[model samples]
Target: MYSFSTRSSFIATPHESMAELWSAISAALPVTEAEFPLDFSEKVEPSVVDVLKRCRQQLYTRSGRWRQNAQIILDLSWEKLNTGTWRDVDKEWRCLYSYGCLFKVAALCCDDASPATVQEAIRTCDLGLLMGAAIMDNILQTIVRILQNEIGKRHSNEEDPSDGVSAKKMKVDCVSVPVVKQALAVPRIHCPSLESFKKDYLDPQKSVILEGIIDHWPAFKNHPWSIEYLQTVAGCRTVPVEVGSRYTDEEWSQTLLTVNEFIDRYIVVKDASSLGYLAQHQLFDQVPELKDDICIPDYCCLGEGDEDDITINAWFGPGGTVSPLHQDPQQNFLAQVVGRKYIRLYSPEDTEKLYPHQLQLLHNTSQVEVESPDVVRFPEFVKAPYLECVLQPGEVLFIPVKHWHYVRSLELSFSVSFWWS
Candidate 1:
């Protein structure tokens, strides 16, 4: 059994800067002295201590041999730490200290270590600490600081302009030419009355681009909607940003960050591996003040839903973002508030040719790349008929329910999509 006093000389006071953080963490842990056994007849394990000591000795060594040896030691130490439980204070403290030391070494070797190794090291340390490890407060504070600094360094490196290649200039392939059938443009009219829209397009389940309708909206005339204005209004608000050139790629991931950080890191400065997109988000719900800027079109009343039942979503991002071919359950009115977007639509009858994904998560999305599809792999895609159009600022495009559509930004854009039953 292990034994140690709260007043033992092994524990030291944490620095002033991290005292509050250390206190908060300590308060949350089951760290009472009464929980530990008092007897010290049995000796603590020596294997974890020896492995951690070796890891520290070679922490700065960047060679392949050192990495292989350190990884082996880390794996062994993690397995031991994960499987053990402690009733004695002294043994638990030693175990926690060893795991923290191992974490520090892994962080130091991060540049040369695999992502899996780094993740495992952090996970093991977190588990040990949470399992009533009585590590010194000062030591725990030090480990936390080191981890924070390493994360800061990684973010800075990603934003560095000298990084070789970036996703900012990547060209998106929008399929312009017809492969199987000749493509036609969607009909466009200026300021059509509600009666005309209901009789011609809505009743027939056809799509038409309506112009001169949204010019009266405050979003069109008053709000500049520039990068600066967006940052000023919604900068501090938390939002989910799509972090890749396209969602179809395996590397694509989503992250939650402030609108300001999204603009600073992704919009103002670009990232080589991924681009940030605020797409299909209910911005109005989070930032209700923005709702005053745009009004729902009169045509939305023709549907079964009331004004309050309409779902309003915002799509804001840089130029290269693409929405893969997909269908929605309700009628959609996509209003172009600021930039230009090239849109293509396919009737539900052509679903067989679109080749929707077999995976449940992506069932609504097509597997074929609409912009530059592979002829041999998706041969039927060429035979599907589609309507194409470039929607300009202040234009609204009516998309019938279950109509397959794909959209790509032609420039820095902000658009609002309204969905109603």
Candidate 2:
């Protein structure tokens, strides 16, 4: 039963409206003190219910000031409701439901419930149950669709005008290969069974180049992941791309760019002086459709945990991009997608010889430049034994945990790395 006070056109005061709403809520969903103690007085401070009621009143009385006041109240309510013991789960849930009801009422009163706003409410209020229920109303549903469409138009208008396609032509200096002692070759295999993979390489903590594995992937066949294809799929998506040759250089820095712009200026147009690399990014999360193109290797099953535990990351860049020698925490399977990469691996025992960075930020990374080493400053680097290989397209490389490795792209490349414990 929806009833308003007869005293005035406006709803009741904060306390009176909260009591009334609480009463209505209780009537709708009755609960006993035995199951969940109604002791909001002891646990919750500043009273989330009071703030919500005030928010509702603001929405009903002053529509212009509602967004600001409601945001404040929502923030306060979230701060109060987010923390509690698991033993008080029932009590917390009841409070959450009431809080969600207040959000619905406020949204309805304001008549400005955008999809983004509703989505936020779902995340912030009772994990979406109440907001989902409220949006079942035709008016709210229509409002959400209209707001979403408007938002899409606004985003389209705000897109970058220059897609880096017409950028001035630049020179790309030829990459120079460093001279080093001949290292053991990484064994290459083609479509080995899971049992063979585990027995031959995985258990031994040895790196191997896997061939003919990802030949049938969508990224390989249907979507070539070419500059045009990537620009079409993820052009609007903003991503962090490295703007210099290596992070260790004084001129090196990170910048945000759309996929199209990155492809245009870095990969296609070519900036010979400073290379751009999209490294160590979880691209699948930003463009979920890309995940459909690739599949996790079967050998990952030999690890300790479930498939969900694996951390998938993308490494995309021009031919000259380089990743300075660094070690990762978890075992890695790096799959070459578009082009080739030259990799050098050194055992964990060579940590002293590698000269790890002293600073916390670059602690996992080696200070020595593997391509052009300063033997005077780092004399021990000469003794470090390593394994070298050129990873071809549609091949995967298994790197054991804590193995110091350096990667340099031999051509315009895109690679996916799967990290698992």
Best by TM-score: 2
lDDT of 1 by residue, 1-421 (tens): 2332323221123454233323332332224334322222234346644544444444323223444554554455455455645433345444544444444544433442333343333334433343324344333334433433443345456755553224244334232433323348888898888899999999988998999888998786687566656754555455668887678878789876667677767666455344678874456654545677888988998999899899998988777778899999999999999888888999999999999999988988999999899999999999998898888899999999999999988767899999998
| lDDT at 73, model 2 | 51
Residue 253 of model 1: what lDDT? 90
Using all chains and alpha carbons, the TM-scores for the candidates as numbered come to: 0.58, 0.64
Error of 1 at 169 (Å): 14
Q: Candidate 1: what lDDT?
A: 0.65
What is the C-alpha lDDT profile of model 2 across 1-421, one tens digit per residue? 2322223333333554333432332332213212222234544555654554455454444444555554555455445455574344444434544444444534432343343453333233322222122322222222323333434455467757664344445334366554434547777898899989888987888888888888898998888776656765565445678888778888899876656667777766554555888874456754556888889888888899899999999988877788899999999999998878889999998899999999998999999998789999999998898898888888899999999899988777899999998
Please give the lDDT score at residue 278 for candidate 1.
87
Which pairs clash inside model 1? 175-371
Candidate 2: where are CA atoms >4 Å away? 1-173, 177-183, 268-271
In model 2, the number of clashes is 0
- Model 1 superposed RMSD (Cα): 13.8
